[model samples]
Each structure stands twice: as structure tokens, then as C-alpha cells.
Target chain A: MRKFIWTLVIVAVVAVFGGRAWYLHKQAEQNKDAIKIGVVVPLSGFDENMTDRIVTTLKTATEELTKKKPYKIQYLFEDGKYTVKDSISAFNKLKASNPSAYIVLGDLPAFGLRPLINETKMPTIVLVSGDSGLPAQSPYLFRMSLSSKDMIQRLASFTYNTKHISDAAIMKIKNNYGDDGSQFFKKYFADLGGKVIAEETFNVMDMDVRAQVEKVLATNPNMILVWGFGPGYTTTFNQLSELGYKGEIITDFGVFDKAVWENIHNKGDGIYFTTIDSQANKMNPQFLQNYTAKFGDKPDVVASFAYAAVEALLKTIENPKGIEAGLYELQNFETAIGKINYDKEGEPHAQIVIKQMQPDGTAKIVKE
Target chain B: MTYVLHQLIMISIYLILVYATNLVTGLGGLMTMAQAAFYGMGAYVYALVALNMPVGFVASCGISLLVAGLVAWILSKVVLRFRGETFVLATLAFQMIVFTILDNWEGVTGGSYGLSEIPRPSLFGWEVSTVPEYVLLSVIVAALITGVFWVMLNSPFGLSVRAVRDNERAAESLRISPQKQLSRAFVISSVLASLAGCLFASYVTYIDPTSFSLTESIFILCILLVGGSGNIIGPFLGVLFMILFPEGLRFLGLPDESAANLREIVYGTILIVLMYYRPNGFKGIYSVK
Candidate 1:
């Protein structure tokens, strides 16, 4: 009977406490004047692992910004889990609660929300897909993140501006992304009176490109331009080695995957590509140190890009009169990625760097 | 801005998921984790077919139905032979396979990034332009689902499905081929799932692997269980409850990240509560869809 009474008392306390907890939760939920900046990310499955580095970056952004701007930037994180429908569903849900949705950060590529965005006029600060280089019909969408076109443009311009090479060959996937990047180079280099002796295209998913690389190498160009990320890049390097083709290589940012690098470690010596950020760079000790302490590992360019996006959004919403003025400030703010800025539509104009994988299997930017 | 429009829209989506999952689990009594696979198939097929095709709304739904039904027929025969846990595992395998196609077939389905900017159905010019209008579309779909489920599940034909669910041998001994009833349930579920998929693709304006996750399948199943499986109101309440309650938590002055995690924890806790007190799942009509 004594134990029973004690148990009954414990149960009563738990029940009362639980009831109070829920009531307070409900009461707090009803409060207005709480400004919310919605966020979406691919948080599970294949994209699940991608969120670890990004989540830390997100945590840091809010914590850091609150020190300066207090609680002005309210973070509402929605998990899109790399699904386009889920991302839109998350956005729709956010809009339902906070309907006058302002500055959002997520990978809202043009193709995903193009029709809806064109209709809604919601000021989305999207981590974008295509660039201004696409066909004119890509809409009035303002991307507050770097584009593949911009990255390639900087890669081509810097390589040529510093007179890095006069003759080079290009190899890429036969897709719009690679094809568009190639056209930019073709137009820019030809105008500059430089020689792009050979240009080749391979299937997008196919990683075996020995014949393709050899055909480009057969042109006897000064450097080989490879434009595939991940496994495709690894395959090109291995094939280039097997064919014993030893000239300079210029590729896009995608080839920097660790497994891809390891796959081509022996062959990646002196191979050149371009990237927005790097994990190995201990130069910016502040971010890397914080990132290391939290995650117990180095941060990837993907994570850095995500952080830069949140940081830009923070600066935008936390300004004197909010987004419009914040966007004005964001357009010119400089960072580790260069003088980062956006046009009126919130698309970022960034100066990309060309990084070379040295003989020792580490990457270094070509300081132009 | 009251999102009565958005809530109605969500009602339509989970309504389809509920009846479809009901057909396999509620009626056919197959605890499928692969309904998400069919839903995804329906989504991708709808997007791909509608891209260059001149198919209108009903036609788009029809195509999705046929495609998903065919896939379901194949899967049901191959995987339904196993009992209980093996069946669930088979469906899980199917879900993973569909996810693989969505993520790896980048050129066709745009890979893991997915096919985006799917145009809204411009069916003969009365545009389903807004979310409210889409909500109406969803209501019609739900009505169709209710009518169809009513006819099939209440009919003697549905009894055979229920009969198979309770005891396959008993249904078989009664001259009702368990295989035949199971096949019909699979087709019906797939068609319903495909319709939802088509609507989902049209409403969301994009389709990717994320839409077809095992978690999504489980979420839909939770809707079935929480709202009391086999009842129409159960799914709606489950969906509405799941979507609104967590979002409502934003009012409290916690940091953004804490609020987000708390929302997830609350969702988990709600499930645990429903499980502990109401395992037959509140409505107790537990005979599967």
C-alpha cells in the first residue's frame, strides 16, 4: 500500500507535468510577432549524409547572427530529403503557416519550381541550378547562389587571363550543363584568338571515357579540359594515365570528390580544375576550427556553399529595413569565395578560383 | 492568411494514400512498405508522360493508373508469395529499387536532383491554377476514392479480399482464389496510388526520389493507423494532425534548430502515445483497407 501510494503520486505528477508541458507548448505556439525565415534541405536517404555538415553550418549561422541581430532571423528548417515534391511540400507547408514567405534557402533549381515561382513572385533566395548563360526563357528567377556557368566562366577566364595556357582541349557530358559550359568556353576562347584544338562529348552517366580522352589528346593540345564530376572524373584520369597522355588537364569543380581523387591519385598529378571552396584550406582558421570541433572532420565545398547561402540570407533579413535592403547589402559582401554579390533578383555573382591537384595528391588554387 | 486551401490540398493527397494503402493493408491485409514505390512510380511516370505528351488530367491519371497497376501486378505476384514479415521486406526492396531508378537515371529522371518544372495541367483551358483549385481537384479524387472503396470494400467482392486477409486457406477453401483477390487488390491499390502520384506531381511541380522514401510510405501508413485504419476520417485527421501540430509549435521562443528538432520529437511522441494506448489504432476497424 505504501509503494502503491508512492507510485500513484509519481503517476499524478507525471500526468500533471505532461499536461502542463503540452499546454505551455500550445500557448507559446499561439504567440504572434515571431518573424520566421523558412529553410528546406534534402535531409535523409542519399542526401541524408549531406545534411550533417550543413546542419552544423546552419546551427552556427543562427547562433552567430543572433549575437549581432538578436532574434530577427527565425530559422524554420524543413526536410526536403532530396525530393522535389517534398521540397515543394515543405515550402507549401511553410507558406500555410507564414504565408507571406520571404527569403528562403534551399536548392530550388529552375526546373523544380519554375512555373510556380513565375506565378507566385515569392522572393526566393534559391541555391540555384542554371545560370544567366541559359536560354532567355529561364525566367525572372533570382538565384542567390553560384551557377555552374559562372564557375566555368571563371575557370576559363582565369586560365586565360593569367595566360595559363594558349592551347587546351575540352571533354564533357553531352548534357545541357556541360554543353552550355562548353559553348561559353568556345565563344570566349575563340574570340580571344586561343586554340581549343579538340572538343569531345561523352554520355552523362558513363564513366568510361578512355577513347574520348584519347581522341581529345590526339589533337596534341597543350592541356586537356575534362568536365565531369564524381566517378566520371575518376574514370577520365585513369584512362588518361592508361593512354600515357601527359599534358595539362582543366576540369570543372566536380572532379574533387575524395573517392574520385583517390581513384586517380597516381594519375591526378598536376591536373587542374576550378572550385568555390575547399576542405583542406586551413587558411580560414575560424570556420574550419569551429567546423572541426563540431563535426570531428573537415567540411566539404557542399557544406561551405550551404553555409554561405545561410550567411547571405542572414545578412539580408537582419538589415535595417529587411530583405530588399538586406539583398542590396548582400549583393556586395565579400567572403572566402571572393567578392560575393547578387543582382537585383538575388542571384550571386561570384569570382571562382582554379585549383590544381598537385603531384602529392593535394589541391592548391592557382593564385592569379 | 488562412491556408484552408493548403489543408484541403493535403487532405486530397493523404486521402488517396489512405484508400490505396487500405486496399493492400486494410482489405487485402498485406502490410506493404512498398506503396511508396507505387506512389513514386506514379509520380515519375506522370511527370515523364505529361512532359511532351498531350494527355489531359483524366488521361494523365489513367496512364499513371495503367503504369502503376502493371508494376504492382508484377510485384504482387513476385513478392506476395511470402508471408507476413517477408512480404513487408519485399515491399521495402521494391521501394529501394524505385528510389534507385529515380536517383541513378539522372538523364531520364534527372537523377537524384529529379525532373523539375512539370507544367500544371492545362486541360482544355479551365486551369487548375491555384492551390485552392487543386484542393477541389483533390476533393473530386477523394470522392472518387470514397465511392470506389465503398463499392469494392463493402461488396461481396471485397469480402473475398477481407477473407483472404483473415485466412488465405479459408478463402481458398470457399472457392475464392486467394491469388485472384490479392491481384485485384494490388491493381486497385496501384491505380489509386497512381492517381495520387499524378496529382502530387501536378500540384508540387516537381518529382524526385525524396517523394518516394520509405519514411513517406511509413508516414502514409501512420496516417492509416493513427486516424483509425479503414475509416475515411481517420486518414484525414492523421494527415491534418501530423502537418499542423508540429508547425504550430513555432510560436514558442526557442532557437530555430531546437524548434525543428522538437517538432520531430513531438511527431515521434504522438506516434508512441497512439501506439501505447490505441494499438488497434483508435478506430479499431482493423480488417486492412
Candidate 2:
């Protein structure tokens, strides 16, 4: 029995690795003529709805690009699962394909891949809203979407100048996203002489934020800044409503999701959040129409970013210079999201706007 | 080639982790869920020192090992008083506490934002920067750990620990101190785990609290359980299987939409089947209860 088991284990190991090697060779041969663009994103483990939207948008955009481009463009995706270790693993797997460029989603994967990107000098575009400093870490790294710093600065300025809010409380999720949002808002708001009277935090997995909401309400601030993503948004909004706190509530881009509004029901009404400027979306109505027609639903901000990333990559590839050079030279490049301009640091600047939730489960632009 | 080297590096690191874990859970009969905590501690210490102190990789690793071992020694004194399920729970609590500290101590740990720009490992005018170099360094460290563990586990101290694990009262009657042996085993296990952590930090160049969460500890424990722990070869086999099996599934050419989920399902199913067939693991002399 012992000898048989040892033989079985050895056979299994040999079969797995050997099969993988064969499969990789076949894949390489098949895609030999195509321009391979590797995509590393969370295909599992974190925010399935968002991943689904991003993947669908990439597929749609890629199909459109394939028809127009002179050469074949193939996208090979590896699931990063939105974690550092898995992101590194995913990038390593994709490295075997020798892609012309890479598209990495989220902040964690970008940070994890920064050193590798510097080493390999791969022209990679990261679609992220948090941590504006990421693109500075690597010359080959380019960013899409308005960074959290930009959006929060706009939001803080709007709050203090337009809304005349002097004091505020903050309720943020406990992860990096929440930390960035809270820290940025506090710094920007404090610079404008606004006082953050109270601050509280809850985990992303928390089903209840009554204690946190109540703690914030006890401070009796003029407004509150809620920063986080996922179910926590719904929970925070619902708890605030249950507690009968009627002060002005502002949030980050996370509340733009339909799921959050639906989950909070009417509780999210009158809440304000910062997101990409709607003027750009208005400028390109056909993208919204095509996405809705194709997917049978409207595209969220994340999907728009994904679509824009593909468009930007296609434009960069068309340039006479290489991807890295083309990325640095991009200015006023129009895409599905809006016109994009990459500074010398490879960080793209986009317009940010604030929107207010309505009782009908839709949001209206309040500030731009 | 880099991808292959990356996997080999990860396997080498996990080998150290599993071998260290075997000392406490496999040989000493103490199931610990705090390996990742010590692992995180080591990584954080190494990262902080390397980033701030301008120390070489060897000194950073030494400091990490020392800090992790000291914490493990203190924790062992408190947790070793309990037995079985209670001991496991105590270790779980420690893991949670460590995770919270790493997650909330934003000033030091960067909170959940994670520490980035960690310099690569260097020793005596040689900088290990490339993936191949990292792979070689990790393998050498793992080999040295294996040699030390091999000698230690074969010594009389190893026999005494096993004797205590099998029957603490009997070992005590025979003049062996259960507390002393178990504490030493636990501390040594943690110190080795920290070394693996140090290697991981330098190899990846980025780490966040999520990398060292409770899930990772469970994953490490699972590797030991699946491979059959009480001995060196058992955990070694477990490390290769647990690390490579999931990675191998990635190459099966599943559809992109369902591939990640499918890989997980298949991996879980295989684990269940393996455990069902071999309760004590393929080559393990002792089964974790």
C-alpha cells in the first residue's frame, strides 16, 4: 500500500506539471501571430459584481478593437483575486505569455506588481481610484480614472465652500480603501479649516454599523463622510436611517453601485458621493447605449473605466513610439469615459463630480 | 522561466513554513493557528528594518527571527498551559490580535494600505534582485532550515518532545519537563516560520495585513494536515502538493469566467478525497486531531 501510494503521488505530480507545460506550449503556438495583452484582475474572491462588469466591458471593447486594428489583439486574463500574493502569482503566470502590455486592476495588484513592472519595464495601465502615488513607483506604469486624492479634494472643497459645512464626522471601512479615503478627506478638509469632530470605523464584513453611526451622530457634526465599499455602505446608510440621523451625508465613489442603493432602499436618499464627471459620459452617449444594449444593463463607473482602459491601450499601441512613450505622450485622448491626459508621472487626470441620491434609486449630479 | 522560478520560490518558502509547523503540531502535539502571526511579525520586522535601518538582508532576517521567537516564547508560556481545543483557540485568538494590530496600526504598519518599495535581499556586496536570484536564495535558506531541523528532530531533545507529546505524564515521571520541551519546540517552530516570512517579504517587495490573515494560517495548517505532518518528508510532500496542485489547475484551460471558481472547487474536492483515504496523511506518523 505504501509503495503504491508513493508511486501514485509521483505520478500525480508528473501529470499535473507535464500537462501544464504542454498546454502552455499549445497556447503560445496558437497565439503566435496575435498581439497578446495580459489582464490581471480579481476574477474571484472580491466583489464579483464589479469583476463581472469589468470583464464584460473588456470583452466588449476588445471585440470592437479587433475589428478596427490592423493586427489581431488577444487578451489573456489571470485571476489576481484582489490580493497581493495572488496578484503576484497571476502576473507571473501571465509573464509566460510575453504580452506587449498588461492591464492590472485595483490598487493592491498595482502595488504588488510595481517592483516587477520596474524590473521588466512592461507598459502596464492600472485602473485604480485609490492611491494616486502608485504610478510614480514605476516609469512604465500608467493610471486611469480620477485618483482618490483628486476626488476627495474636489469633494472636500465642495463641502466646505459650496455647502458651507464647518464640522464633519467620518465613518469609514477598515481596509486600505477606507484608510485612503478617510486620510485624504481629513487632510483636504482640514486644510480648508473644516473640523473632523468624530471618526469611527467598521469592518467590510460588518453586518451592522449602528454603534459607529450612533457614535458619529453623538458628535452632532454638520455632515458626515462615509468611506468604504461593498455591503458596508448599505449597512452604514441603513443604520444611519434607523437611528433617525438627518444630517448631510457624503460618501466616496463606492456608493455609485446600484446594489448599494437598492440595499439601502430609501435610506440613501439625499446622500452625496463623488465620482467621475457625468459630462464625459454625456459626451459619449453611444457607449452607454451600446453597453446597455449588449449587457442588458447600464454600465457602472468600473465598467466605464475598463472600457476606457482598452480604448486607451489601443490608441497607445497605434502610436509610432512604443507603449511607454505613447502613454507619456497621451493628451486629451478621448475614450468612453472622457478625454484623458497623462502627466509626466504617468498619472491620468480626469474630471470629478458629486452626485446626490434620489428616493427613486437613482443619483443626480449635484456638483462638477 | 520566470513563472517557473516564481513557483519554485513560493514552494521553497512554504517548505520552510510547513517544516517549522511540523515541530509543534506534528511532533509536539500542539496545534497552533498563530504561525501566520509570527510569519507576519517576521515579515513586518524585516521590512521595517530593511526600509528604515539600512541593514543588510541577513541582519534584517536575524532581527525578525529574534523578535518573532521572543513573542512566540512569551505566547507559548501562556498558551501551553491549555491542552487540545483550548490551546488551538488560544492560538487563534493570538492570530486575530496580531492581524488587528497589523491592520489598525496605520502609523507603523501602513494599516491595510500595505508597505511597498521594500528593497531586495543583499549580502556581502551581492544584491539578489532578479527572480532567479531570489529562487536560489530561498532554496538555500530552505535547505539550511531542513538540515538544522533534520539534526534537531533526530536528537535526544526530539525524542523527549515526542515522548511528552505521546504522554506528558509519562514523560514527566521519566524526568522530562513537558513545559520546557513544548515551549522550546513551539519557539523554534515560530522562529523558523519567521525566517520564511522574512524571505517572503524580500521576494515579493510588498505586503499588507491581508497576506498574513487567519486564512493564510489555516492554509498552512491544511498543508501540514494534508501532507501528513509528524515527519520532515511528510510536510515536504504536503508543501509541494498544496502549492503545486492549485497552480497546476490554472493550466487546465478552463473558461476564463468559471476557471478561478472551478479551480477552487476541484482543489477542495481533491483535498477531501485525499483526507478521506489517508486520515494520517500519506507518510505522516501522527495525525492532527
Candidate 3:
């Protein structure tokens, strides 16, 4: 009788724990109307600053959305750490950890997540540098940021059409992002009847770009086209200013961070960069006010893109047009980042705007 | 289900890595830091050849092994000249140089943007595409590697290497060439590292320079050190503890923003406690006399 009682006690204890686990798991499941958004971002590592802004803006967007939607919307964020392995690990973990309606990838490269996303078949909005072949690989994948090619063409057009600076030169970091921008700008500018006099490339961590700067200025081009990010970009500017080359400098929108630009603004005074238009700020005044009040400053382009991705994802989830079809039908959706439209390739069709940095570290839109 | 499989695959890959690391750092008593470099070389070589040619999995692995072995041999010449901390510093230089080559050699390695669309490993034309299939392949490969490692640890060559690790002069007195033994050990370690890298590249279908930074080398070393060196099982357990313990933190209900930091703290505390209470590690075989 004692042995039987002990066995019964063990079984009962196991049943209680198992039953509670099952109940918790069931509670986590959606009850016919809840939406889960899985956000993969670099919450740690080199890209943390950018993701910090994105997470704040994304939360604001989600909160604003919950009020307007009938369903209870929730977000589950995962840290990708800005590496391919970590990104995929985070994606897999997110899927297993929760039930997500869709995924939003912030500031991570698109190619690394392409295979995994194809496998998952989850509707994903990637807010990062775009790749032409990414969407085709995974039909459920959509991009919220402008492609490097698109931005380069816009920069080239503005410089040639408005500024009328014909002779141009190129110096870029020898990486994919830089290579894309440099190649496109060279071809487009050359096709527009401008001569690319000098083209030089540097490694990602090359601090002293004096040699490349000298080669670029040797051609005495009417303008210089540069490409890079972070300290490398700033280092190039420092070398150019020190070399006393006063030609109009052109680069991509990545150099638009006010904090980074503040110190190097005067070095490249006539510097111009191209990015997706800031009409989102114009259209969503309330969002801007709230974001500014919370963060004590305005959100950057990356943050705006992240916010747009969340808003678009939530809208799709609430109305439920199916995964691929719903994202496809999400055309001309107005968000904090202006009117958003995606081409058949899932590439954003947002207009590009060129802005000139002032001495005070503020950027003004170039009308032309 | 797939998530668990993914973690298992990752564990298998690191098992090979930590095994190779144990050969050099645990058994050989060398503190080289070029494991990530060799791993990257293997990944880049495999990805490039497979993408540009009609090579299958075996051929790609062979070529990657050859390239990694050659690099390891050349580095060993310089590394064998140093002792103690100097050896580590020299290998650190090698790691940085290899990383620079991978990052700047844009035409071949694809530079910072990384190489993607690497074909899945196919054996006799059977594609390993699904998570379950990949997991099985990884398990088989890991088992084969472990079997080889076991043979090596019990062999005459393994004994000689361990002798050199224990005492260079005494090993020489016993007619063992420390230079030759250390060199062989390093070359073998590099070969294993390359194999792991090839598997990772094929499995992930992407290769980038960021994955092979100095930080990664330190991480591999931490696995061996914390798991207790000088034994095969120690490294295996170390890899599992290092990989899975942190992963289990995901279920702790911590806020997302603080979870990553807290996980790090928890792992750091574990390491500290282990170092204090059981320096030889749970399944460790060697201890300071």
C-alpha cells in the first residue's frame, strides 16, 4: 500500500506540472484575433545605435496601431547581432518561441536571411539595403528601403541635371554596398555625358584615405563621388578637407547621421547625399512630435524605414489579405515614411530626395 | 521543430570546432588564435569554387581542406618560432591578416557584402535541403570526426604531442621532435576547422568576413577553456554548455531588451564559478599539479 501511494504521488506531481505547461502554451496561442509580429534587429553589436532608434520608433508605431485596430497586436523582438549566423538563429528562435503573423528585419543584410526566409515561408518585411534578387528568391519577402542602385541614380541625376557638374570622380570602400553605389554612379554619370576622371577603392577599415584622395583630386574633376559608412566615410572627408579639394562631394544617405555629420560637416561643406524622401515626417506630424518628445530628437532615415515596416505589417495583419497577396496589395500606404509602394519585385518605389548638409549639422532638401 | 534542429546543427558544427581546438589548446598546450582564420578560408574557398564551378560537396570540401592546410602550414613556420604568449600574439596577427584578405579581396570573397546562394550539399546527387536532412548529415560528419579524434588521442602520435605539451625538453630527450609534432597538430587542427567551416557555409548558404573575426577565435577558445581541456568529452560538454545554456535563457521570460545582456552575465557568472570551484571543468581530465 505504501509503495502504491508513493507511485501515485509521483504521477500526480508530474501531471500537475505538465498540465500547467499545456495551459500556459495554450494561453500563448492567438484566440482568433491576436496578431504577433516578429522583429529581428541588431539589439547588440556595431549596428546597435541604429537599431535602438528603430526599436523605439517601432514601439511607437505599434502602440499607435493598436488603438486603431480591432485585434490585439503584439511584437516579439529578437537580436540578430548584425551577423548572418545570429540573424538566422534569431529568426529560428523567434518562430519556435512564439506565433508570429509576420516578421520585420531591421538593419540586417537581405541576402543572409534569404534562404531561411524561403524555408520559413513567412511574410517578412526587410528594412535594410536592398538586393535585386532577394524578393525573387523568397516571394514572401518584401523590402522597405531603397536599393543602392536607385539611390546612386538619384544622386547622379541631381548632380548632373541641377548642379551641371560634368567631370566627376569616384572613391569607394571596396565592399558590396560601396561597390554598388560606385558602379551605378559611374555608369549613370558617364551616360549623362559626364567624364569619370578618377576611380579609386579602399578597404572597409582603411583610416588614412590620403592616397586615394590625392589620386581623385589629380584628375581635377568638377565634382567627386564618394561612398562609404561610419568612420571610413568620415576619414575620407577629413583627408579631402586636409588635401584642400573643394569640389562638390557626392555620397549616399548613410552619411546623413546628424551626430556623425556634426564633426565633419564643414570638411565637406558642399557635400550632398541622396536618400528616400522625408515626406514621412511631413505627413505624420504627430508621430514626429511624439518621437521627438520621447527621444529628444528626430528619428533618422533608418528609424523611419523601420517604423514604416511595422505599420505596413500591422495593417496587413489586421485586414488579412493573405501573406504574399496582402503585402502586394499594400500599395500607396501612408506611414511615417511618406507614401509607400512596392514594385512586383517587392522593392520599395518611394521617391529619392537629395539633401545638402549645412555648417550647423542640419540638412536642407535640394529642390532640384 | 525546425528551430531545435537548427540548434542541433549549430551544436554539431561547434562540436567539431571545439574538438579541433582541444587538439591544439587542450592536448598540445598551445594558445593559438587562428582557428577562425582557417575556418573563414575554408568557407570562402568552398563557397567560391562551388558557386563558380560544377563541383559537388566532396570536391568542394577537398579543395577547401587543401587551401586551409597550405595556409596552416605556412603559418606554422612562423608560429613554431614563438613560445608561450608570443605564440598567441603571432597567431593573432595571422588571424587579422586572413580577415583583411577576406574583407578586401572583393572579386573572390565578395568582400563585406558576403557571398550568398551557395548550393546545398548534395551527396550522390541527393540534395540535403531540409533541416532534418541537414541535421542528419551534420551528425554523421560530427561522429566521423569524433571517431578520428578518438583514434588520434590514443595513438602514438597523440602521445608524443601530449609529451611535447607537457615538457619540450623531456619530449626531446625521448627522441620526439617537438617541432614536427606541434606542426602536425596545428595542421590537423586547421584541417578540422576548415571542415567545420565548409559545413557551415553549405548549411547557411552564405559566407561573410564578419563571421570569422578575432572575437570568434576567442569564443572557440572559451569553449575549450571553460569546458576543461585535455580530454575529448570535456570539449564536447563545453560546446554544449556554451551553446545551449545561453540558448535556454530565451525561455526565462526576461524582457527582450535586457535578455541578451542578462544571458551574457549569467554565462559569465557560470564561467567564473566554474573556474573557482572546478577549474578542470566538469568532465575535465587535466589539472594543474
DockQ of each: 0.20, 0.51, 0.40
Tens-digit lDDT track of model 1 for A55-158: 66666655654565545445466655444544555666566556333333334334455555556655455552444432232333445445666766666776
Q: Pick the candidate with the highest DockQ.
A: 2
Model 2, A262-334: lDDT tens digits are 6888788898888765333442355556668865667777777788787777777888898889888889987
For candidate 3 chain A, the 10 contiguous residues with the lowest summed lDDT are A100-109
**Deviation from native of the Cα of residue B287 in model 3, angstroms:** 8.1
User: What i-RMS does every model get?
Assistant: 6.1, 3.2, 3.7
Give the TM-score of candidate 1 (chain A).
0.74
Worst 10 residues of 2 chain A by lDDT: A278-287
Best by lDDT: 2
lDDT of each residue in B7-59, candidate 3, tens digit only = 89999999898888888887788887999998888898999989998879999
Model 2 docking grade: medium
Q: All models: lDDT?
A: 0.67, 0.85, 0.79
Q: Write the per-residue lDDT of candidate 2 for residues B195-242, one digit (tens) a residue.
A: 999999999989999999999999999999989988888888898999
Relative to the real complex, the DockQ score for model 1 comes to: 0.20
State candidate 3's TM-score: 0.87
- Clashing residue pairs in candidate 2, if any? none
